[model samples]
Target: DIRDPARPKRLSAVADSNFSFWHSASFNNDGTKMLFTDEWGGGTQPRCRATDKPEWGADAIFTLTNDQMTFRGYYKLPAPQTSQENCVAHNGSLIPVPGRDIMAQGWYQGGVSVFEFTDPARPREIAYFDRGPIDATKMYVGGSWSAYWYNGYIYSSEIARGLDVFELLPGGLLSQNEIDAAKLVHFNELNVQDQQKLVWPASLVVARAFVDQLERSSGLTTDRISAVRQSLTAAEQASGMARRNALTQLATQLESEAGGSSDGAKVRMLASEVREIANVAR
Candidate 1:
């Protein structure tokens, strides 16, 4: 859009019907979508309070089509804040989730939230980090001002506190493989306004991440886990079709046993990834 910076052109104007006040905006990789924030109350009041409307101070995701933007949906911080907490939606940036649309955002005292907007109509939060309000007695007018994902880490500019750094850890809503895949992206310069899409390379790290998740969740049996580790180790050291077949066979066995386990769905899921990894390794 800024092809001619000397005479910048305004392609669109989102008026009051969309939000009360627009604080900041970001574009997804590929520039196919744009996400805007509604800093209701000018970000100095408790706009994230229980009494506030979901759209009053939230991030709205919009898809770009034919040079036109269409409203998708809103992602407000789920946690309710008290009048004493100066909470409201603020700044955010994308988290590189291969094959998916994910973002890490800050909501003043509402805390840091990493979520998925792949399906703009229904965005979901995956991981988060927040502390007790700055002051439980009064509105402190302080919290996270910005949270952006760059390279392999998420950098947050705290209003009162100095800069803070965060890393994505495996959680209920996000798998380790997904997180690892995201980290493959590296941006030399990340200007919030000039957003860019993230692209991740396909590699063994992804497959190993899936193994780590299954190991942590006890999705695999002890013996199966050992076998999987061994096969993966040998395959990494091997450079032949036999290694690929070995991994494939292991994946097949895991898949076959998945339906019989309590965590069958997850097991089957991991097996599929492992299968793909074998093909790549071979």
Candidate 2:
């Protein structure tokens, strides 16, 4: 906690009793929560082996309250790493996703991991990228140093491989709407230590992305996807309040039948977004 630019003071510190070594940390946008990583066996140690404890080289999420931090849980790379690889949490940063707590982090030879930690105790990876190790035969002290989310893109600085850039695609555990919404968030200035708060606005593009997500996830059948696209197109092409009402009605029907699909909740959410878009058009 550096309150003064020149004179930085430590408010509180956790000891080795809590873990082994403190590597890096990231706080939520509000600064109400903190996530710290444990460098158990150092960067060159393979703490990600099958026999390694999850807490040894993992991220520990803490809920901060009135100068006190409460340990929430741990988030480790689920993938097993070789004893030769430097598999431990290094550095990471938060991705602004409204009320959700999502982060993209770096793990030496473990690779870069993008995950959600809305429920600190139940963090899960959504997207990741990893290539063959520095050398398949041997693992030296070379891997990603930091993986952070800046603006709408993810940047990774490797020790030996140089810089790596990635664009998070909408798939797996995320939807197009979610990705689009996340991209909408921007920062004029970003300092890793001085994290900024994020706010997102609702818009038509977000609604379209939701519909796209539904289609991509197969949440709706091909016929249903086509019908939904046609309806949205017609609503867009139509004129007057009549068109608005028509779109609203279609959205209402979709919302009402949301329970019928495997992704019912998502369908309901998309329907509501469509309805909101219709209202905006009106």
Tens digits of lDDT, candidate 2, 115-195: 887668788898888774777787687777889888889899988889999988877577666777878888887777667
- After TM-score superposition, the amount by which residue 209's alpha carbon in candidate 1 deviates from its true location, in angstroms, is 7.6
Q: For model 1, how does the per-residue alpha-carbon lDDT over 174-212 read when each residue is reduced to its tens digit?
A: 777778787888878888666665655546666666566
What TM-score, over all chains together, does every model reach?
A: 0.73, 0.71
> Model 1: clashing residue pairs?
29-196, 29-197
Question: Model 1 misses residue 205 by how many Å?
Answer: 3.5
Q: Cα RMSD (Å) per model? A: 5.8, 5.4
State in Å the error of residue 42, model 1.
Answer: 1.6
Error of 1 at 60 (Å): 1.3
Question: Which one is best on TM-score?
Answer: 1
Error of 2 at 129 (Å): 1.2
**What's the CA error at residue 217 for candidate 2, in Å?**
14
